[model samples]
Target: MTEFDILVVGEANPDLLLRGDVRPRFGQEEQLLTAADLVLGGSAAITAVGCATLGLRTALLAAVGDDFFGALVRDQLTTAGVRLMPYAAGGVPTGVTVILSEPDDRAMLTLPGTIAALRPQDVTDALIQSTRHVHVSALYLQPGLAGGLAEVFKRARSLGRTTSLDTNWDPSGAWASLDDILAHTDVFLPNAAELSAVTGAANPDTAAAQLVALGTTVVMKDGARGARAWWPDGEAAAPGRPVDVVDTTGAGDSFNAGFLAGRLGGHDLPESLRWATVAGSLSTRAAGGTAAQATRADLMP
Candidate 1:
């Protein structure tokens, strides 16, 4: 029997969010007019929390330093009911992200600490065999894992496990060397910009089509406008929910959680997209990614 409904393989970090209306200046300047919050972050962690909130038996496999920040990361995941299979990166400190939040969008400054230390070796074969589905997030942030990601997905597929990949923006902008992994992936979740970056297509529809042609389902997340999904059989678009946007920190990850949760529960693509849209839109009601996430009850009629 599968031990976990979803196994999330990626980074584990904390986000220190500073919410305000002012931008940074060149010279020395101090402008603090709003609030500050420390919350659970990292695409994998946030998605795991969102999956747990949706009543999935979610497990997180990631690296963190044996430090206070690591403890905070673990505590938050445990509080959200996600099982942790964390590896401690010796000597390296836990990763942390400084998020400068505006009304519609936010800029993040990340210090990739232990996250860079995560390797494919950290994901054990036993863990892969025991999970029904595997989800990898923030592909570029984890260099150690990125190098062998294709093999990892292939191994999961060989084990009869469903696999998903969410390649969050690559800082280096070299989106090559992903075709092997994309071919093995069952679901490919990318934001509009990431889709364009990965496919080199100016049009979002073309980008999605290109990924679908690779034998992977493409779910393109378009903020405010909504989400679109393309598979072999057909394609569908779900309109985004209108809400007072607070911070769009981990909305995409939240959307992944909802989408994957629905898929694992045997929901069709259209129904899954509806849950994904609502989960992502609701996540923006707070300052951080995991905050304001929808629970199972919230999705009920």
Candidate 2:
């Protein structure tokens, strides 16, 4: 039997959220922010935490600098019950994102730092062999991992491990190279915008169909509208749960965690979609990605 239920391979960073009504004028004048705080901020890390919270045996394999921010990241993940196999990069600073939050939406300024330095070798064969599922996230942030991700997923499949990918908004806008990875991905989780962007399709249905043609199950997430899943056999959708909105950071990752937990536990697609929607909505109830995450008991229908 595998030692871990899920292995998350991706970035780890701390988010510095600045909540306020005022915008910076950029003239070097002092602008006071209403509130500021640091919280867990990487897509992969958030998903790993969510999975562990839902009672999955989860591990995170990523890179972080041996610095203050890195320490914070480790503490948060460890507290959330996620085993860490993190590389400590010397000299490089730990990655950090500055999120300027408004009432409706937010903008982020990110420093790549150690997040961009993750390599393929970090995901060893031994790791893949010991996990029942593998999840890859933040494709564009880590060029080294992105280059060899296809082979990684293929090898995982060969070892009888299912795989999932969440290529969170590519900053470079070059979404053409993910087809190879999708060939080995069992679950492809993308937001409606990401689905459209990656496939160049005008609609979510077309985007999902294109991914389905690539031999992967496609789950298109639409915030507030819930999620839709397309498999070879059939397609299903779940309506979004109503919730008072806060920060939407890592909501998609939380959804991925919920869906994967249900799938690994033998739940059907529609049931998994329901859990996913619940998780996503609940995540937005707090100011940070992980604060309002639901536990397994809380998610029980």
CA lDDT scores, all candidates in order:
0.90, 0.90
Task: Estimate candidate 1's RMSD in Å.
Answer: 1.1
lDDT per residue as tens, model 2, 223-243:
999999999889999988899
lDDT of 1 by residue, 177-293 (tens): 678899999999999998998999999888888888899999989999989999999999998889998889999999999899889999999989988998999999988999899
RMSD of 2: 1.2
- What residue runs in model 1 are displaced by over 4 Å at the alpha carbon? none
Q: Give stretches of model 2 more than 4 Å off.
A: none
